[model samples]
Target chain A: MINATLRELSVALAAKRISAVELATLFLDRIQRLNPALNAFITVDRDKTLEMARAADVRLAAGDAGPLTGIPLAYKDIFCTEGWLTTCGSKMLSNFVSPYDAHVVERFKSAGMVTLGKCNMDEFAMGSSNETSFYGPVKNPWNTDRVPGGSSGGSAAAIAARLAPAATGTDTGGSIRQPAALSGLTGLKPTYGVVSRYGMIAFASSLDQAGPMAKSVEDCALLLNAMAGFDSRDSTSLERPAQDYAHDLEQPLRGLRIGLPKEFFGDGMEPGVRAAVEAALAEYRKLGASTVEISLPSSGLSVPAYYVIAPAEASSNLSRFDGVRYGYRAPEYVDLADMYRKSRAQGFGEEVKRRILIGTYVLSHGYYDAYYLQAQKIRRLIANDFVEAFKHCDIIAGPTAPGTAFEFGAKSNDPVQMYLSDIYTIPANLAGLPGMSLPCGFDAGKLPIGLQLIGNYFDEARMLNVAHRYQQVTDWHAQMPKGSA
Target chain B: MSLNLDQVERIARLAHIEISPAEAAQTRDRLNAIFDLIEQLQAVNTAGIAPMAHAVDVSQRLRADVVTETIDRREVFQAIAPEAEAGLYLVPRVIE
Candidate 1:
């Protein structure tokens, strides 16, 4: 039952096979069992979870429930959940209770979904590895010594361990897909602005996007249907009509053109990961999709360019968390300036402070044109590369990361090494294109290697279609860690 | 392109993040490493490229100036402030 996908859970829910409260309790119990070892969830309030479940139960009983009604899903702590501790895995807001709900949180609430709990994340969605999380790094369920990828590490680890059926994650430079890749779950980052970011803790606003992470592409599609829509409140949100992301799940891949970027398959990739991604591509070929070698010339610049832009945006966006109005305040300070400095320094983790400093430096008067403006120009070049690549193929394929999950401290010491893990996934976020990752195969050590599929802007349905077809003939998504069961 | 301790200290102040002297040395090394890594981008010819501010070409969206959200819950919002007096967040004195 814990291994069931969202579709199976939805069917069971709709048919009254299980009560909403019962389902929430089942997962809650499993979470209580496994979360200690995994650290997937930061906060699991039984009272709040059960209370939400009871409300969902009422909706189910009244026959006013939607497809997601009674479904229990966890949210990454970045989203502000009214009355719940909405820490973005940072001590700055660790003790802060939100007064409002994030747009994603409100969508789940309206769908009658029960909040399982808040999942852990990198502090303010900063790092590629979950090690940056102040709550403690989430362990890869496959190997206890390895990390689950970050920003959405908790959500990914939760799904991988079967602690939760599905969850929401935010991606700013591969937060969703990279963690999804490392944890061997189906992670999607829809085209920018598909989901509103109104109440999500801001992190590089331009690149930040919320998407679904689940056990299967079909499950992700179902969740995306509920999570996406136009919101007038968020200026960046596209005013597109709502469409079922699951509509094309059964579409044949006969004429699909899959682009294999020559850059992603280069020397950067581990042999095992390259082998797994190549195997997935051959499977697609058998499914009648044709593969083409495409060039994304500017992809090489993605990591450096992202470091400049994302942090610049983060530096500006996070300025809201000063010591006065909300969030952490220094316990001892002689003056206003002293209070602000001590509060931020003490509240934020290492990576967060580093990013803020870099952001401040780049956007500073003498450096704006040299660093910030130049990164934006590189952003344009990278976007142009995707535009050129997409013209030749329907979707781009690659290894989600250069290698499989590594031990917690392996790349944490060097920020550059950590940033490189996101190389393949970052381009999509840069271009605001939809991207998804799913388990293709396991490496020598048995850690999962993900095959990433990136689509043109607003191409989620077609991408889901392609992923669904691959999942149909393969069982990679079905495999779980030996002890997880 | 590497930042020295003084620049790191200045950047920290600009960012409103206080870094102690011991931490400053390490922060300088890390930031300098990153800056060195990014220095490669300077070689790309982007003279004619228009800077992309977002993934999609979208202009700043505008709405009618009518109040969309009311500050009616101002107190509720400030309830979490570390110190508040009469619904005002109390910070260290700005005036001498």
Candidate 2:
């Protein structure tokens, strides 16, 4: 039951082999027992979960249930789930009970899916390591000593630990892919605007995109079909025709061109990770796909540009928490100005404050042109690099992160080192391209390593097709952490 | 490009975030380190390149001005506020 894919779970659910209440209870019980060691879930309401499960059971009995109906999944704390505490892993929103649901949450609810709980994340989705979360770092399920990647670390850990069959995650500068990579799961970040951002806590408006994290690429595709849609609420939501992301999952990869960006394979990658990524590519060759040596010359600039652009946008978006309305407010302050200062300082975590400060500095009067604008221009070059590379290849492939999960304090103190961890994954976010990470292999230490796939705009089906084909022959994604059951 | 302690305090003030003298000192060092990382962009020439503010080039979709959300749950909205009175969100006094 713990290792079942979404499709298998759906089939079992439709066949009435397991009642939705029983299915939900299975995962809810797992979460109760395992979450203490992992800290993957911030909130789990069993009564509420069972209530939803009972409702799903009703739908299943009615014989009008959808593929996702009665299936339980977790949501990252970033999404505004009404009646649930949407913390975004920060003390500022620690007390925030969302009045309404995020668009993604509404979609899942409409699908009749049961919400298992809310997963933890980095504060305001700012950090590369989950250590910055107000809730303590989510320990990697593979080896509890190492850290789960962030800010979607909690979501990845929950799925990998079998606390939930699947979960939703948002990627702003590799939040979804990097954590999915580190935790040995399959997670996808769709093309920008594919999923509406309304009511999802804004981190970096342009870069922040919500996607799915699960045990398989097919599960990710099914989740994406429910997640992607046009919403009048979010002005940036794309109005493109709906796509069946799983429609091409069975497509042949015989004539596919996989782009291997030299910049991604160059330096900073651990030899173990390199070996695993290369072995994955060799498997692709056996499946009849060819690799093309491609160059994304401006990708090296992605990290610096991302640091500037993401923070600059985050500063403007986070300015809403000024002790006026919802969220945390300081108990004592001399006046309005002091209230704003004290509330924000007392509310936000260190990394959130640091990013806000960096954002304010870059967008400040004197530094605007030299920092923010330059970063934006460089962002264009990075995006243009993808446009050029995609001309020669159908999809770009590489190592998700430089290495496997690291120890808790490995790169937390050094922000630059932490920022560099997302070097390969950041380019996708910058370009608004769809990218996914699937389990490739394990390191010598038995830690999981991920292979990243970046598809051109709205080409998610092809990417899933490629990943689904690879998953057909490899058991990497099926390998769970020891003692996960 | 490194930020001094005073400059860090000034930035904090502009950002409306409180920083103690001790926190400011530490923040200055970290911010300087981050600035050192960001300084790499300064060496790149972006001549004749337009700033990419968003990944997509679509213009913001205009909507009808008519009210769409009819739910006037002022009670629900203000329920989470730190302070509220007579359907108004109350904050610290702005007037002297």
Candidate 3:
């Protein structure tokens, strides 16, 4: 039951084989037993979750159930759930409980999905690994000593460990896809503005997007169908018509063009990861999909460009969390200025402080032209590279990360090495194109290797279709860690 | 493109955060390394290419200027600070 996919769980519920309350209890129990080892969740309210489950069961009884009507899902701590602790994995928001639901949360509730709990994440969704989370890092379920990838590490870890059937994650510069890659889960980051961001606490406003992480691409598709839509509240939300992301899941891959970017397959890619991605491409070819070697030359510069642009935007968005607001504040201060200084100093983690400083420095008057402005220009070029590549293929394929999940603290001392992990994933964010990472094969140490599928702007349905077909032919995503729940 | 310790301190101050001397030194080294990598972008000629800010070329949507609703300031400020005796965020006096 714990390892069942979202679609399976929904079918079981509809058939009266299991009640939503029973399923919720099973996940809550799994979370209670396993979260201590994984630290994947920051908060799990049994009362609220059971209440939601009860409501879902009632809806199911009335035959008002949808595909996700009774499935349990975890929310990354960043998305605001009214009366729930939406900490955003920062001490600054430690005591903050949102008064209203984020658009995503409201949509999920309307679908009658059970909220298992809130997963942990990096503070302000700023870090590559989950290490920067104030709550502590999430352990990869595959190997406890390794990281689960991050700012959506908790979400990935939870789904990987079967703590939740599915979970929601937000990506800003590779948070969702990278972590999903490391943890061997199917995670999707839809095109920017496809999912409303009204109450998902802003990190890098332009780059931030919320999506689903689950056991299969089909599950991710169902979650995406519920999560993606137009919302007037979020100024950036696309006012496009509703989409059935799962509509083309079983579409035959005949005549599909998959672009393999030369830069992605070149240096910096681990031998094992390259082998796994190549093998996945071979399988796609068997399914009648053709591959073309293309070049995203500007993709090599994505990491540097993203670090500057994301942080520059982060510095501006995070300004709202001053001492005067409804978050952590210094207990004692000599004056207002002292209050601001002490509050921020005590509130933010080391990585958060480092980014704030870097963001401010780059956006500062003297350095803006040299750093921020140049990064913005490079961002355009990176996006253009995708535009050019897409003209030749329906989707681009690559390794989500350069390598599999590294041991904890392996690259913690070196920020640049850690930043480079997002090299393949960052370009998608820069282009505001939808991207996904699905388990393709295992590495030498048995860590999961992810094959990334990137779609053109608003091409989520096509991307999911490609991923679904791949999952249909391979069992890599079905392989779970050897453990007793 | 390299940032010295002094420059790091100045940047931190400009950003309105306080950093210790040790952290400033560390940040300087890290930022310099990152800047070195970013320097590669300068090699590309972006002449006449309008910098793209967003993926979609759509213009920003405009909304009517009419007020849809209003919030009570007193209630809004209620959670601004731990102690809000008045309709304001209470803080220690800064000015002399």
Best by lDDT: 2
Which candidate comes out best when scored by DockQ? 2
Q: Pairing residues by index, what is the TM-score of model 3?
A: 0.97
On the 0 to 100 scale, the lDDT of residue A223 in model 2 is: 98
| Candidate 2 residue lDDT tens string, A403-442 | 8999999999999899999999999999999999999999
Clash count for each candidate, listed in order shown: 0, 0, 0
Recovered fraction of real interface contacts per model: 0.88, 0.90, 0.50
* Candidate order by decreasing DockQ: 2, 1, 3
Q: For residues A18-126, write the lDDT of model 3, one tens digit per residue.
A: 9999999998998889899999999999999999999999999998988889888899999999889889999999998887799999999999999999999988887
TM-score, ranked from best to worst: 2, 1, 3
The TM-score of chain B in candidate 1 is: 0.89
Q: Who is ahead in TM-score, 1 or 2? A: 2
Q: Stretches of candidate 2 above 4 Å error?
A: none
lDDT of every predicted structure (CA atoms):
0.92, 0.94, 0.88
Q: What DockQ, on C-alphas, does every prediction get?
A: 0.86, 0.91, 0.58
Error of 1 at A330 (Å): 0.8
TM-score of chain A of 3: 0.99
Please give, for every candidate in the order listed, the TM-score of chain B alone compared with the true chain B.
0.89, 0.95, 0.81
